[model samples]
Target: MGLFSIKILLVLIIGYFLGSLNTSIIVGSIYGTDIRKHGSGNAGMTNTLRTLGKTAAILVIFGDILKGVLSYIIGNIIITAIPDSSTLYISGIGGMVGGIAAIAGHNWPVYFGFKGGKGILTSFSVVMMMDWKLGLILLAVFVVIVAITRFVSLGSILACAAFPIGAAIKGNGTVFILFSAILSILAIARHNGNIKRLLNGTESKIGEKKRA
Candidate 1:
């Protein structure tokens, strides 16, 4: 393969593997349990908190966030090493590709029976690395929605929905906007069950504990 192809392959492979780490699962294992079999049957930060405790949840969240940040950094580093690049736009696109790969891996981790978290935290981390301004805006939106509704899923959905709009408003390139839209769609799609429960008023609130 060519040099560019090699770089893209490396980015996707490394990013996906990093995301597939499934921090919650690893943390859960340390406690002699599988997080996916616990509360909400979801392997994520909130679920980790419900199943394990604050400490485990914090560790999982940190690991997941680092996955996104590291993927973005690794992609940019690879692209930077390549010669004959006239603009940094190529690196930006490469970083997006890597970030998307990580998000996908997080949503459906290959290491954990293809079941994983919704990718909200991972997406947020990636967006923060890509554009701090847009990241802060989305963070504000998430916090406001969660504070009012006390529904983390609602906050996540709204934040994901806002991502593409924020990118467009920030005058990001077409490729970036398109990638942001794709990420938004993926995030929302992963929360379809939560959306249904939300509409039916059966969704669990932020701090609700799952029945054993």
Candidate 2:
């Protein structure tokens, strides 16, 4: 393989390994529980909170966010090393080879019996790589929705929707727009159960007092 190809592979490896570090699994092991076995039974931040309380959940959120950032950084470095990179503006998408690798890794972490949390953290990082401003705006939407609705799923869904608007505002290329759309789809698909629960009113709202 060419040198550039080699470099790209390295980036993907970094991203995948980093992404494979599932926050929920790590925390769950610490507590002698599989996060997926208790509470709402999801492995992402929301479920982590329901299972382990605020401190553990907050740590999971940060850990997940960091993994995303790491994946983006790995991919960006790869694209930048090569000339005439189409992924320059939103090059992170191409590197999403790495990003998705990471998310996939999280979903089925090698270290955690091939099961992991939802891709919420990866989505957060991927969106940010599209554009930090866009990512921040997306984060704002999630924050607002989650803060008011107490539904992390709603915030996540809304955040995914914000990608296109942010790309348009920045006048980014069609590739970024397409990338955003795909992410929106992935985000929604991952939340299918959460959406159903939300509709059925069985989904947990953030900060709600747990019943005995």
Candidate 3:
């Protein structure tokens, strides 16, 4: 394989493996149970907070965010280490590609029977790494939505929708805008059940206690 191709492959693999780490599940195991078996049955920070409490949830938040940041950094390192990589916007592209792979792995982790979190936190981290300005825009949108509605799902969905728009507004390249759109789609898709519940007015709001 060409050097560029090899670098891309390595970045993709690293991102996937890092995402597959599944912080919630790992934290759950430490607490003596499978987090997926309780609460929302979703292995993620929100569910972890509901099922395992604050400490576990905090750990998951850090771990998942770290996965995205590390993936981007590592991918960029790989791209920059090779000659002629800068000719194709390879640094940015590689980082975004790794970020995408990380989100994909989080959603359908190979180690977790292809069932996992909805990828919100990881997406936030990746977006931050890609462009802090865009990330801030999404974060503001998310915080406002969640504060007003108390619906984390709504915040996440709306924030995801804002990604591509924010990227475009920032005058990012077409490729980056396209990648942002893909990430947005992937996140919204993962929230399919939440969307249904939202429509039915039965979706759980943030801080709502999990039933026994």
For residue 12, model 3's alpha carbon misses the true position, in angstroms, by: 0.7
Instruction: Kindly provide the TM-score of model 1 when superposed on the true structure, using C-alpha atoms.
Output: 0.95
lDDT digits (tens) for residues 3-122 of candidate 3: 777888898999998888899999999999899898878888999998788999999999999999999888888887766733555348888989999999998899989888998999
Model 3: residues with Cα > 4 Å off, grouped in runs? 85-89, 210-212
**Model 1's lDDT to the true fold?**
0.88
In order of listing, the candidates' clash counts read 0, 2, 0
Full-model lDDT for every candidate = 0.88, 0.75, 0.89
What ranges in model 2 sit over 4 Å off?
Answer: 1-6, 82-96, 209-212
TM-scores for all candidates?
0.95, 0.83, 0.95
By TM-score, rank the candidates, best first: 3, 1, 2
Name the top lDDT candidate: 3
Query: 1-212 in candidate 2: lDDT tens per residue?
Result: 66556666787678778888999878878988888888766678877877788889888988888887778767877767666533334445546656766777777677777767778778878777667787888888889998899887899887887777678778887877776776677667777877887888887677753322
Question: Arrange candidates by lDDT, highest first: which order?
Answer: 3, 1, 2
Candidate 3 matches the true fold with a TM-score of: 0.95
